[model samples]
Target: MLVAAGVVIAALTGSAGCYTDPGYKGRPSDAWIAQLAAPGLDGRLDAAAALGEVLRLQPNAPKVVTALVAALADTSDPVRVAAASAIRHAGRGGGRVREQLQRDAVPAVAALLADSAHPVVRTQAVAVLRDFGPDAAPTSAPALAGALSDPDPFVRRPAAEALGALGEAAQLVAASLARAATRDGDFRVRRAAAHALALVGGPPGTVGPALVGALRDTVELVREAAAEGMGQRGADGLSEWTVPAAAGAGDPMAMLRATATADPNPRVRIAAVTALGLVGDRASRPALRQALADRDATVRREAEHALSALHRRGGQDPGMEEPSRADLCRSNPGGPGC
Candidate 1:
């Protein structure tokens, strides 16, 4: 067992200096391992990063496990996220590590689930937590449900995905997700809620109506999710809302023109203009023509290009009929986009 443990230690540590003695003369000490496991916050991201490296290197080390549990219990959010990730690796067997985490009751990990300020981190944390499976303690259920309403698309999306892992608790989460689908400020959040509903693995025929209602969502992403879900259930007669572009508020063509004419969030504006060409809403010509004159080069280009595409295609954009084969993946805006 010691030899096997040593081999695992070597495999885990690899090139890290933690495997060797301070002067390359003796076995690594508990003190050294503990130091590497300590969570650092006081603007010492490097220190936390180093500790994470050490934990990653020694998945089965009792000392490493002890240090990680301590880190998971730390007050610092970043440190907690690191420890949770490290523990996830150790717990790949799916029982002891999860039990340890549940017993720790670290709020930092929960708080990280709602950290919209950093969307990427929030998404990644949610993804890791969901792997804990249906047996995850009930104490964390409310926290996961609350995240369904997160402001950041990346944060809320993953929260939806995580809720799916809760098994029976998923019914409770579905209520929260439903509320978010209709009321959340971010369209992406609503879409995530809708997608998460499907992932519950319940009766598809019964859930179809709720998903169909989401088709009317103001944001394209939500509409897309709804449309895709409806398509999967073989529901037809989805009028007004059709491939690529769906009508809202007024005539489909007119709405597209106005959307292209106005609407903040440059990406949304651009997508709206593109939708006009796909829908072949000719009534929007005036708006599209004017959009071609806008100062923003991309918007102008999209407007002109879309107008040309519409004219050539004779209305109605192509390839809007497909639905995703799998459930919606939680948003992940790691790095800058988050």
Candidate 2:
């Protein structure tokens, strides 16, 4: 084994020479690559971690990406976990590296998502897929959707969460998420499903009704996620409460107000305040003002920020318009209003 390591190191530094990034002070010796395939678990695990650092130092190198791709199938659980982590580092660059991940590394990681015996591997695999962005469709969407059915919450949570990252491609699985949001046994899975639904977006009629139903989930966290999804309906003019009208006064604006003002969980109140700002609902001002005194400092701060955003928008209204730098600076990232 020692002689084999020496031979491998020699090759890395030979005519074909090792690849090195600006931060990489030395060539990535083949010994590290060999360790990746070594019989000892620690050697393989350490190799995966070392490769992660190499990728960080010299990102977008296809050679390392190929090596890490092979590591994804390592029988040792730790090595697979480490390899998944390293894949993220290798695939960080948007162009070539992302393309490499899409072609080489990503498929291997996607395969791991179905490994029901190891939930951590699935979670790490989801992390890698999250970077695929919208282009992840035609493949990752279905794979991620399938993960939502995994028995382990650790696996199901990320699968449900990754679907939202697909953007419009999420439409492929939006109905599935709607079902998961309402019926998943675990509160975390349901909460994640509800939150993901907001990002995937759909006709307010279909998506909105599903999310509203979640708002009344016995679990307060699920309700918080449902409240958040309504605010994120973007600029669409759809009513957020039509589906739940029969259930009672399901006006989302009203629900946001109620949750912001009365939920026992301070964290949920904090999310409610942030959502009010995103929804641009000026009518929520009174409840938000009351939230200004919330026991949780985070809730108080979110309330204040929401009020400021509302105030800025109000200044933009026709008759109430002002030339104050506040709203103007909002259009631009930094200025006097900032």
Candidate 3:
């Protein structure tokens, strides 16, 4: 083994004379190639660094990608690190590298996602799946949804975030977020679900309820995300919120108004009001008018204007209008509004 290492090294450094030793798996030429490819040695930063350069120099090399994928199977930390970096590099460039990532065994990829002890490796694995995007189609969604239950947010957050990029995967993962928002123990997971919901933006049936529920979430960040997600779902369905007949008297707007008016976190309260506007109904007049009296001056002004628009349109309105920047800001402060 020592002699083999020496021969590989000698060929890499170009010290071997012109020779054909059949016994050497790696001839002098192979050594130079290996050196250029520069697979990292046992648990050393430099080896990982050199392997990174090799990936850059030969981005299209199938052997290098395969070798890196194989490295993940090793118990050696250094080799696994180098391998992870190499796969990440390949994944970023797409094309052949992306294909390779998709073909990699589930357990190998799952190991990288599940093992939180190595944040760098776990992040890389999630990133690879993210970059794979459409190419990852079928597998990406399932892998990410599964990761939502991971022991670590470092892994789970990225997985949730990655799902946002999967377009078609949105519907499938929406169920997971719906479930997670209600049951996940970590505040961060709930927050991640809200963020993922924003990325998977769609119609009212798909995003509205989840977002509305998020407004009432115990965590402030999740509430913020829910508000943002609603805005991203477009400004159509929520237009009637400013009218008297909108969403009916028992509409969820009442809940949003209560939160907007009195939530402990000023931001969450603001988000609640903005959500009400997005779901605009004439019946919201009393609530929005009540908001005008809010100590938060921003909420007061917006409430007055949203009421004005709803009253002007009456019942024949298109149920969709671009909310003025001033009005949106009043409800959400810095939030992304209609």
* Candidate that would win on lDDT: 2
Q: How are the candidates ranked when ordered by TM-score, highest leading?
A: 2, 3, 1
Better of 1 and 2 by TM-score: 2
TM for candidate 3 is 0.63
Clashes of each: 1, 0, 15
lDDT of 2 by residue, 71-154 (tens): 777777788889889878865566655666676666677888767778888898888887677786767787788888888888
**Residue 292 in model 2: lDDT:** 74
State TM-scores per candidate. Answer: 0.49, 0.71, 0.63
What is the C-alpha lDDT profile of model 1 across 195-286, one tens digit per residue?
56544423333343445456445676765554333323221222322323332332322434555667554554576566555555455667
Which scores greater on lDDT, model 1 or model 2? 2
Shift of residue 8 alpha carbon in model 1, Å: 27
User: Residue 93 in candidate 1 has what lDDT?
Assistant: 31
lDDT of 1: 0.51
Off by over 4 Å in 3: 1-47, 56-58, 92-94, 105-111, 114-120, 165-168, 201-210, 235-262, 272-293, 300-338
- Model 1 Cα shift for residue 73 (angstroms): 4.9
What 10-residue stretch in candidate 1 is worst by lDDT?
1-10
Model 1 error, position 76 (Å): 4.6
